[model samples]
Target: MNKWPVFCLALSAFLVPTAGAAGQDVQAGQILYDKWCAGCHGFDGAGDGYAADYMLPRPRDFTLGIYQIRTTSNGSLPTDEDLVHVIDKGMPGTAMPGWEAKFSSSQINDVAAYIKTFSPFFEREGAPDPLEFGRQPRREGIAEGREFFEQIECFKCHGDAGRGDGPSAPTLQDDLDFPIRAADLTENWNFNGGGSVEDIYRRLRTGMDGSPMPSFSDLIDAQFMTEEQLWHVAQYVHSLSPEEGPTISDVIVARRFEGDLPASPNDSLWNQAEAFYIPMVGQIIADERWFAPSVDGLWVSAAHNDEQLALLIVWHDPSESPDPKWLEWQQSVAASMFPLLDSVGVTPLPDRLTVQFPTSIPTGRDRPYFLMGDARNPVYLWQWSSQGDVVPEATATGLGNVQPRRGESRTLASSAVWHQGEWRLQFGRSLATPDSEAELQFATGELIPIAFYAWDGSNGEQGSQRAVSSWYGIHLEQPTPPSVYLSPVIAMALTVGLGLLVVWRAQRREEG
Candidate 1:
């Protein structure tokens, strides 16, 4: 037999059921399952509900019996209590509705019992071996236990060393990205609901809703584990230290940029300048005629290698002039040297400012490049390099002409022209009403999207009768280096320790 499998089987024999599991109610549980859950989870416990296909993550396929999320020991079955809890709490942002008030406590308990019947591994026995079953007790002699932490996906978010600083930390923001913190497995105290082994098991079994965690109940249904596997994985996760901190690289500083536009006449010549500001504002727009005057615009800040910045402008004029003013305004504005404003988070490095309105331009090294207007209009071309030299104008994508309805919105697409090192791009949008909004991706290339916000009127401004008046800019670039944390370290240590033990044991056997 494989030494690893033998060791696991030997270590878990102790989890065999006591008299408590031999008694009452497997059939009673079945009756309840048919009444309450058969509609979605199927009579056979396979997730094949009429509505299951429509769900994004897909409904639980209990027939496979592999639970994706739970607080129980890895490979071991979830306790009866674990099943009961999820039915009551209800999953957030999903079709799973809570049964806390809908079903009585007894009904919920019955349903929990019924769920276990679908998975052959679901045991109503004594808890698995805490060392081999619960969290691999961070015991001194159990070398393989530590190694098990990394084999599973524990270190992906929770740092390798049991800290919570995994590589995906920055993207897990508070607002846009669910403020998810990989469990600091080593800290013990930071455990969300509770620090006990069962508590952790529950999280794994049910999977936290609204977060990346997924329920693992179906994993058990798949016959992936025979009781022993579940217990071992859970024990490994539990053994990790929870108090791990982040390394310097994991530290991040959020920043913004600003600038001002020079005053211009209200004529068709200002179309370039006015078009440049379309993405800046949410409402209002320049009439169709180019060169027809009056434009509303503002200046925005400059950026460093790893920062994100954007400008928003909203125009509401509907009058059509034979001589368009928006295009002219866009050209005049993008050509200005002072277009790049102050720093939003980092200090501005000294570099020449090249303004290119509508033409596509070549970017030099990695310093920074600017995406001016729409690619079609070749109004102005410019570049800013570290040596403080203004490179002559190049082909540029001029500003786009966007005329949305009273409650409509439109987006402008432009290339992230390469500058010094990384590429840069810009987008313009016009919102005709307060409730109007638009989202545009700079390009579908290898880029990290940055979220931006801007407002033209009061907090609750209403353009009920007026055109949409709001705009947003999405910044794209490769993600910056990530900060290090302890979770990964602990997980790595555990995995390496297990592998070494396996090798060492083999050598000892040969010597014997």
Candidate 2:
């Protein structure tokens, strides 16, 4: 859909009054809601629609009368206009899509009023002040806010630089006791509270209920911070995007070193390498993907130290894989179809993280398909997965040619840790592992073609049901050689000596 029309509609919604508009029809709203909202939020407003269980942060239970995005103060009910705004804009990074273009103004107005009928809170609390946000401050205001952010221990959970990787980061959880992660402030686009400065300010004061995020309104009063100080922190937060460009890169040059390779995945040394953002598309062929991939972006980073190279991959998933219900459902369906296949028994389908490279980086050779390679050419796959009690490092040269790697215990080191709803996996091996034409060797300053693939077992991804990325380049950056420093001294000496030679040649020419 063309965004200009929707943008114009959203702008108009703010200027004019939407509440008590011509369309106050509850029946009309119900019709529209069923057509749109019922897929994720149940018709009864119980938050148990067909797709709701798979969603992260989950959908709001209207019966609870607690809305995350609201104009009313924290714990207070939202006015009619607040509901209309959310309907028009919708939630950005979730399953909720904006309805600006699909529905007319009357439909939106009608639905906003009708949804309130889901709970008794609307009738009992007849009136509440609809909050209004004003202009944001200049740089001075943001600086003052940064001060308050530190004084009140916001840095403990949000990080000192507001990157969301604070000391207390990995321990966060949701109201249901499920693991949850703090939002990375640098990526403001991921903020569920809305991206505008005003939206940030509102979230700062109101706070998200049922999550680790805390309400600063009470904490502010105790700290003796002025009212304006709150807005400043919001401004400071809004300004926190990485000072250059997106923090993610698709084409990355691995950080190279000469000495000691870092073995620990959590070592601070990994910070020297920048994370690359690998975007994945659904493996839609053959109905391979049973559902839309909840994961879209996978972060990668690499570093090499003479003997070995380490690559890290991380992604977020609300639920862990091998869920008993999902596993049983698939097994039952298989048993009904083919009793022979059922005899194989049921087991956990482990999540897969794979790194791919050209079998050999020779000239005039066509690399294989980003998948397991085409019929004509093959690719090298280094796969990491967990089995009954063993974490295996398997190597494959083609689609179905996987084999156990024969090498030292540390030849291909890999480990995975899931925490706070995110998966972190690190893989490393000898620079010359799988030491044959089947593997692409790592070398400094060499450009190598690489691809990536991921499988989420909880999403019913197995066999061909995986997310994959197109081919991209990886390079090991070359350091300046020590011999380069002597060039300046040689040039200076040559210039002086050549100057005298030229003068003598001129005198000899005059004599001739």
Candidate 3:
């Protein structure tokens, strides 16, 4: 029997509306909302729609008139323009999708106008003008900005390096008591409103409503900080993120080096290697499916000498696995996602990562199954866990069928470090091994298939419940031959000689 109807009804009752809304006669907007928004925001705009329970930081209850992206001060209504802006741009890092391409300007305005009718607050207290945000000042340096960041205690929630692993991050909840994670300030591209300096300044002044963030207007009124000083804080936050997000590439190129490979992730030699970004998604193809994955992506860099190969993997994580401080956070997430299941007395587990390769290089397009291979074609694996220093080599016929390759096959070595809110791991191995039957041998200029699997133990990710990636290729670049360089020099010398001979012949002909 289909249980969707029963499940939605029970969930809707659990999430009762906080306020009542009157019927509005905006026929056009009502038609659009029913078709696009009702599935998540509910028919009455109470945010009890069928899909609400499955989402974290659940859908916004429009009847309350509380919004997160706004230019107005806290506890105030947003302008009509603000509403239209959110509708057009949508909320990033969430399920909401931008409708600018799908809807016309008039349609968007009509929808924004209709949304206001859901809450009586718009009638009772009208939206005030947006706050004044002056232009950026020519400050001496980011030194003052850094000072302001510490003075305001931004580190209490955003962490020392703005990676969002502060002590208070684990206990934060939204206005509706749903668990919420602090923004990882280092990733400005994920910011809901925008990532520009002006955008950061506006968010700082107004703050995000219906969330733990608070407005700083009182500080200005009380002489705690001048407006320009607040701008410095914005500048400091803006500096945390890179100029642009990393670009995705289909292949990772391993550069050949003359000297030994980098011994650790922090080695300066790694600076010369190119980093490749790979995006990850929750592994939902198998049983015990995971819909939420803490690790979003990874940055990989590879280098090889004649005898050895080294790979550096970097990723951001809010907490070191099994940390006592984040234990409550683990329980809170479990309770929110699976309220009926008993999550008490559950302990955090170690973080894990698996690097997969085919047991033998494929001569054609045919390769082993992506899910750790099938019975017919097995896979070779280098598995690492945060609990130990050794990286074990293994073979797997399929998921949950991994077997550690003891004896001479266990040749993988690794080093790892977790600081602030980031983890850096380096894996090193020989280019060729005696156990070629079970191990993949590296060759220059060959496109080797590779894939990745990661488990964030703090987020209850393990075994099949983890983040995964599809197949990608890695190529070991061959060193340039000496003859190639000599050819270019020889061509230049020949050209010069030919030009001199032609000039001498022309002079001789004129003299005769």
Q: How many residue pairs clash in each candidate?
A: 172, 0, 0
TM-score of 2: 0.61
Off by over 4 Å in 2: 1-22, 141-147, 159-180, 210-212, 219-223, 243-276, 280-353, 358-379, 383-393, 397-402, 408-437, 441-449, 453-512
Candidate 1 TM-score versus the reference = 0.31
The list of candidate 3 runs beyond 4 A from truth reads: 1-25, 138-141, 389-391, 481-512
The local distance difference test score of model 3 is 0.80
Which is superior by TM-score, 1 or 3?
A: 3
Give the 10-residue window scoring lowest on summed lDDT in candidate 1: 456-465
Q: Across residues 101-157, which tens digit of lDDT does each residue of candidate 2 receive?
A: 988888888887767878888878843886555566554487777888788788777
Whole-model lDDT, model 1? 0.37
**lDDT by residue for model 3 (1-512), tens:** 99999999889756643232322235567678888888889999999887776566678899999988888998889988898898999887676778899998877876776788789998799789988887888773467879988888888888999888888988888988877888889889878888888888888899899998777777888999988888888888899999997776667778789988898989999998998987777675666666677887889899998689899998888889977777777787777666777654288777888889999778755567778888999999988899873337889998898878878546689888989889889999989999888899998766777888888888777788788877777777677675654444344333333322332344356324
Off by over 4 Å in 1: 1-32, 91-95, 120-512
Ranking by TM-score: 3, 2, 1
Report how far off residue 12 is in candidate 2 (Å). Answer: 34
Instruction: Provide C-alpha RMSD values for all models, in order.
Output: 25.2, 16.1, 14.0
